[model samples]
Target: MMYFAPYIDASGLHIPSYTDVRDQLLSDARSIFGQDIYLESDSQDYQWISVVANIVYDSFLTSQAVYNARGPSTAIGSALDIIVKINGIKRLPAAYSTCYVTLTGSVGTIITGGVVADINGYEWTLTTPISIGSSGQATALATCKSPGPITANVGEINKITTPTFGWTAVTNPGTAVTGAYAETDAQLRSRQAISTAQSSQTVLEGVKGAIAAVSGVQRSVVYENDKNVTDANGLPPHSISAVVEGGSDDAIAQAIYNKKGLGCYTNGNVPVQITDLYGVAAVIRFSRPAYVDIDVTINLKQLSGYTTQTTTDIKSAIVAFINSLTIGDSLTLSSLWGAALSANSVPNKPTFSITGVTAARHGQPLGTIDIAIAYNEVTRGNVANIVVNVS
Candidate 1:
């Protein structure tokens, strides 16, 4: 007879079923007390054996969990947190949203420690003091008081919450750079894999890896034009173009300067100067990812157990799927069906059937064709942009 015991082999830890453990316990008891021992479900001896078997089974499960936690791919929660430290990276904490607001006031006016309010009534604290210049306006960076993905659109942050002498008005010229929640296990795992390429044999991969490891960098891509002529993307000959989202301009410039090959040209719209240890300064350029707003429409036929919450869940699922696409990743119409259906949690059957799914760029008519994304553009999705029609 085969014995059910926790064992480690080439396949890693193997755990036996509870039934097998209980049966083995009963078999051992029969041998210990003799073949004719009186033991049944109602007997005290059998009940005691069942309890012991349960304890043993739980111990085996604990052992399996411990074994899996040692590997980065299988670990989760705190275990994964510890494993990632081996790569010299810690989980990124949540960040506060920030935006630039232009302050219009009397020239030569100085304002310190001020606050601006968006239309939503959320106050954004100015990160630095502002002095009205000769042009009668000055711009200051403001950080939201509350953290985690707060956003303020252009012209929405027009209220001056902290009225200071000579500080008359405030308005954001561009949309706020939204903050991020604490990095999830999946995002951290992906980042850890990229960080290993910091010492890659290829120069391009090394440059890409170094940029990705920068603090606050959410997503990044590196493209090279090796030919003697400029490529179709307008990248110069023998140059690299890095499209990055998030992170400070100075930090990003230094990362690129550290890993790029000697005499390699960098391509981007934003330029930042980096000074070396010898006081030698070089200008490095890199692009920030452009956002392409995506609109999705999901039509579903409601089945039993479907409620209004189900529709909300379906819309959220679709929006998440769209937002998860990396820079340059095209939006496929067929993929939305699976993303929509994943919202159904009802057992045995789905709560809804997707009759049709279509997507398009914001303000355009929805269509079944996949939307093409540029190399430096990322898809942005909003829950409001998603419409779920149920019948």
Candidate 2:
């Protein structure tokens, strides 16, 4: 039922729409047999023509999909090797988070693996054995029940439910880091389509493009700390820094490994280290994005006629514009106002004021919201975030 272009190219030789094909066939039948054919009525001849036209129209659509490179042939993205070869980049699977699970027991007591803990009803299982020493406690690496960005929060998992022999208590020592979801079909298609234009060559932009193809990655920026350039972040000469967000440590590391040049230093606060195909070690790091929240107040003097849906649509348009911003982007009042008035079916234009603009770090517990955000922040807004007053 989805609508597609009814023509294949500028010549419009292909008839992709059933309605258009049916109408044309009906017209042609009338011209061939005169008024006796009665093609527009519900005659047996008309029924047969309709069925045949439907089948032909479907064929046109399928042929169009194949010619447009959007057919089922491209859906074989499940094969990782095929995806890498076709898209010129490897798609990463879901990523897991590693954290220390604490266990309390008598001195010298051995805390066994598979001991479970409840973090707000989510389970975390220990993998390595931990021996209680002078501290009468132990910590071992544990993995989340499932992987994804949901486990990336700090201090979100506090409660421990599973009891272990000779252990008094159990809890996760810190927030789970570097969990991520699997790649989706739409996401894969988008990555593949974009890479098709550049061929995924081994260039700076190509490396960044490859990283962007990784699942759970929101945005990435690649930088080269070249010679004669005094690096502010204290990188070795001729090093590369791959700053990324919303990605697991393992996935991001592999993405960098697949694309980075040999002998280049991988810089940043890498949660984990990854070795490239040639056994070259590189530290892949993540830079979390800050979220900026904008509070908009609009006063509309209804001129002529405007529907209530128009007001609702205006709010959605404004919020959509705000959310479209990416990392290292800034927000301005003028841009926000323009977005509000750009909504379709909105019948009125009114003056507005941005009463407040505030931003905060994603996980900052106690921080003031500033009126403006820095370049490394992304904006978040919704219909609920905008207030409209109509008279």
Candidate 3:
């Protein structure tokens, strides 16, 4: 069997660990005996958290659910992973920051900068040679991101010559090579350089968007209270609070409903803020690479409540609160730095599924409630247990 204890505070229900209340309960019992010596307790009463989730049942303040259900955990390790896999799928540059690959000649070949935005991810390797002539083009494995200033010994596709002769190893240099390779034109190389630069810029946009998204989600869950910090103009810290008490279901439920009220055509569901935790499942950060990544997050918090009620009323109020919420209350995702989606690739935004709910206020359950949300990164899955006494 478990023991119960609680204390009240002005403006809200502040429940600490079970240790304090347990000692108090034992002390109260010991006081009955004039020669009070020692009191007894059990191992089950040692921990603060509950074995099973339960709600507080107090008549003074109506019950409103303070529980959330975030089903299974995604096996993602870092913030970077989440952004790349679930947030968006983008096309990266052929190589890191450099749009153009070096054209090394093997004594007689021309380098061709092909116009393509994407290729198989594994197809790119460091220092994959670039070429100028037909034979040089044959060994064209894309040279992806390389370390600091280093020239790739691409063997036969040397620098772009002035008049642009696409020279292939001549049994002779004149007309022995393929028509395309032997008669290279100056215009082609110039045009290719311009196109490559433009493509790299697009890829950057998508990466930046992903980075911004991850940063924001981290802020919402751990950052706690976010006041007028954005545009406070150096004012003192403002207030960010939620008053959940034992108020009646009538005003208590409705107060939260109106504030986070959204898409309420059917059942009453309390509104919750959802952010895209993109960096949780995909990319691994490298100190320096070809392109940069930027992630964005949309934060949400409920600032609503009613003053007079009991524990039970709060539970019903919790259900109605969720129902009144709508979807669009989020930070609009912008295309920052990215390669434009080609004919093959498209963007992947965050997808969430919230499939469960548990409630408790004074120490009893109103019942088990189940909910489904389009996004899962909205609320914390586990909540601390309730500590209640004769309050």
Best by lDDT: 1
C-alpha lDDT score of every prediction, in listed order: 0.87, 0.61, 0.25
TM-score of each: 0.81, 0.53, 0.18
Q: What is candidate 2's CA lDDT for residue 321?
A: 70
- List, in order, the clash count of every candidate structure: 0, 0, 95
Off by over 4 Å in 1: 1-3, 22-56, 101-151, 156-171
lDDT of 3 by residue, 193-289 (tens): 2223322334322222222222111111101123545322222233122222112323333322333212222111223322225533211111111
Please write out the lDDT profile of model 1 over residues 1-391, one tens digit for every residue: 3455677889888888888888888899999889898788999998998899899989988888889899778788899999989988878888888898899999999888898898878899996667899999998999998865555768989898878888899999899987766888888888888888889999998898898899888878999999999888778999999999888999999999999999899999999999999999999999998888788998889998899999888877887777678888989999999889889896469988888988999889999999999999988776767899888
RMSD of each: 4.4, 8.8, 28.5
State in Å the error of residue 42, model 1. 12
Question: How big is the RMSD of model 1?
Answer: 4.4
Against the true structure, candidate 1 reaches a TM-score of 0.81
